[model samples]
Target: MANTRPLVAQWSRLGNSSIAACKADIPRPALVSYQTVRHASGKPASKDKDKKKRKTRNTFRQYDLKHAMQFSLIDAMHYIRAFEVGQNPASAKYEMHIRLSTLKNGPVIRNRLRLPHPVKTDFRICVIAPPDSKAAADARAAGAALVGEDDIFEQVKNGVVDFERCICHTDSLQKLNKAGLGRFLGPKGLMPSAKTGTVVKDVGNAVKNMVGGSEYRERMGVIRMAVGQLGFTPDEMQRNITSFMDTLKKDIAQLSDRITKDIHEVVLSSTHGPGLTLNGEFKSANSIPPKELAGPL
Candidate 1:
C-alpha cells in the first residue's frame, strides 16, 4: 500500500515538469490495486464502503475499468469509509476523479467513457417505403401506410410522410420522460425517446424530428431486466436479431467492407439476462466495447 521509491520519483518528476508536452501526455494517479502492487501482505486491509459508516472526510474518484488499468471505473470511484494507521498516502483513499488544478479551459484528463454505434434496422416495413415507383409511393403516402426506417426517410426525402401522417392515435409519445427515454436511448446510442416522438404523419416530419435532435439521454442502469422476452423461440428471436444486425451491417458497410478487420469480438445473444441465455453467432474477437467509441449522449 505504498508508492514505491521509483514510483514516487516518477510521479514527482511528472508533478514538477515544466515542459507541457510530456506532462500533458501523462495521466497521473491511475487506479492501481494496492494488493497487486504490494510486495508484502501488510497492505491496508480491504474495506467495503457500503457496509461501513462514511463521513465527508474522504475523497473518491470514479474511473472506467478498461482505461483505469485493473479496477473498473465504478469500483474505482469508491471512497474509504474509515482510514487506518500506517496507510500509504497515495493508497490511503479512492482518488480517481480528474483534478485540473491549473487549466481553465483545456482537454479533460481522466478515464473517459465511450459508446458504440447504434443498432439500426433494415427497411423491412412497407409504409415507410420510398417512391421508387409513383404507384408504390402514392399507395401509402396518400393514406394509411406501414413504414420502416429507410421507407420513412424515402418518403420524407420525396415529400410523402408529413404532419398529417405523423398524427398519433395513442398518447404514447407524451409519456416519454427523462427516465423512460434514458433506458434504451443510452445503451443503443439511439437519439430517440423510444415512446415519445416516435410517430409521424409525414416523412418530412420524421426526418425533421431526427434533425431537430429529439429526446436523447444517457443510460444510468447497467443492470436491466431483459432486452426481449425470455420465452421467444430461436427463430423468433433471430428475426429481431437480424432486424438489428441488418441495420448494424448497413451502417458498417457505409464505412468499408474490410470493417470486419477491425472487429475485436462478435457476440450474438438472444436476450442478455437471467434464466434464458441464447447465444449463437459468428463474430470476431477483436470487437471493441461499444462505449469506447463516441456516441450520441
Candidate 2:
C-alpha cells in the first residue's frame, strides 16, 4: 500500500510537468500597434506615404523626359525655329501630332483658324469650274493658281497637280471624275469633297479661305496638322496653338466623356526637325496620370 502511494504521487508530478511543457510550447498573443499589425500583413499603414513616394518618382521621370519634350508651346516654337537655321523658310511650318485612344470610326474633325500670324507662302489653289462661268472669274480674282474646266481636268489627268488645295463647284464634280482625277487627287487629300466644304457654289470664297486655313484630320487614331510657321512670334504661335487645342477639345467633347484625357500625348515638330513632346502642363485637368495612360492615346 505504501509503494502504491509513492507511485501515484510520481504519476501526478509527471502529469503536472507535461502540462507545464505544453503551456511553454504554446504561443502568446502579440501586443503590437495597429500600424505594426497592418505592416505585418503586407499592407501600408498610410496610403499617403506610398502616394508621395510615387509622385516623387513620377516627377523624376518627368524631368528625365524633359530633354525629349518642350515645357510649353512657346518653348516648342523656339526649338523649332532654332532647328530651322539653315532650312528653307517655306517648309518650316510647325506641325502638331496627337496620339489618341483607339477609336472605332472616330469623328472626322476639321477646324479653320485665321492664325494671328498667317503663314506667308504662295498657297496654290485650283478651281474646277466652267471657264465661261462667273465663278471661274471670281476664283481668278481670289488668286486661284488655276481656273478652268477641261484644262484643269487635263492637268490633273497628266499628274501635273501643283496646287495645295482644290476648290470645285458642286456641278463640276462630274467633270472631275470624267477626267479621272480621282486617282490623282484622292491620294493627296486634295479632292474637293462636300464634307470638307471644298465642294460648294461659292468657289471664290472657298479658294480664298482655304489659302489661309489650316486643316486638321484624324488618320489612324492620330490628329496631324500644321499649327503655324516658324516666322511667327511667340505670342502669335501660342494663340494659334491654343485655338487649335480649343477646337480639338470641343470636338472630342462632343464624342466622348473625357475630352482632355482622351488625348494621350501631343508632339510638335517642324517639317524638317525632330519631334518634341509637349509637357503634361498642356494636359487637361482630368488627364490620367502617366502610369495610367497605358492602353490608348
Candidate 3:
C-alpha cells in the first residue's frame, strides 16, 4: 500500500494569521469545577493533619516516681475497694500495672496463665473444628459459646466476631488458613495460632484453660491487666496478685535463651480510683533486687 501523507501541516510552516485562527478554534480546556457542596460526613481537608491530634503537654495521670508511697498489696486492695463502694460491681476491677526494667527494643514478655481467681468468669470461647468431630463435641461440652468448622469460617468472614476467645484443633489448621479469616480476626487478636497456644490437639482442654485464664504481654516495657474484681475478698486478691507475679517470673525463666528481666515498679489500682504504688514485696523472694523493683532507680 502507498504511504498516506500527514493531514496537518507543521506549526513552523503556518502563517501568523493561520496560527492565530487555529489557536482561537482550539477549544480552551474547561476549568476543573471542585465540589463546592461539602457532604456532612466528609472530613474537611486540612494541612497539618499530624498536629491536629498532637498535645503540647502530658495531660493523663502521671505517677510521681521520686517520692512514691509504698502501699502493701492488701492495703492497696483495700484502698481501691474503698473507692468502689456503691459503684457498679461489674466495673470495679483491680488492675495491676507492672513496669519492667526492659528497653522498648528489648525482648518482649508474653505468656498465658490461669489466674488463681479469674477476674471475669464470662468467657465466650469459639472453637474451630469439624462440626461432627469429637473435638467439636468436647469443645461444646467444655462450654464453648460457638463451635463449627465451615460455619465458624463463614461467620468470621461476615464479620460476626461475637466471641472473645478462639481455639482451633490442629486438624482444622489448614482449613482455617484457607478460609482467609485473618483480616477479620487478626486485628481483634482472636485468630487461633500455635504461638498463642490456641491451636491445640485437645480442644476441650484448650477451651477449659482459656475460660479461666488470662493472657498478659509486655507493651513498651509495661504489663497491664485486670487482676481481680471488687467482689473478690482480700485473700482472693492477694492470691491472684501473687499468682500473676509468679507466672510472670516463671515465663521469663522458661525462655530458651534466658536474659535478666527486672521488675521496675508495681502499681495497683482500680477503675475510677487512684493508682497506688505497691511495696514490690511480690518479688521479695525472687531473684530481682528489691531496690530496683521498688521504684525508679
Model 3 C-alpha lDDT per residue in residues 51-109, reported as the tens digit of each score: 78776652223455779777766566555666776887767788999987654455788
User: Model 1, stretches more than 4 Å misplaced?
Assistant: 1-227, 255-263, 266-297
lDDT of 1 by residue, 236-279 (tens): 33454444434333433454443231111222222211121112
Which candidate model has the greater lDDT, 1 or 3?
3
Worst 10 residues of 1 by lDDT: 109-118
- TM-score, predicted candidate 3 vs. hidden true structure: 0.70
Q: Candidate 2: deviation at residue 282, Å?
A: 8.5
C-alpha positional error of residue 245 in candidate 3 after TM-score superposition, expressed in Å? 0.4
Q: How many clashes does each candidate structure show, in the order listed?
A: 30, 2, 0
lDDT digits (tens) for residues 5-112 of candidate 2:
443454457658847666555433331243355456886445586887773221111123335544555455555666777766656687889876644453555555
Against the reference, the lDDT scores of all candidates come to 0.31, 0.69, 0.75
* Best-performing candidate as measured by TM-score: 3
Model 2 root-mean-square deviation? 16.7
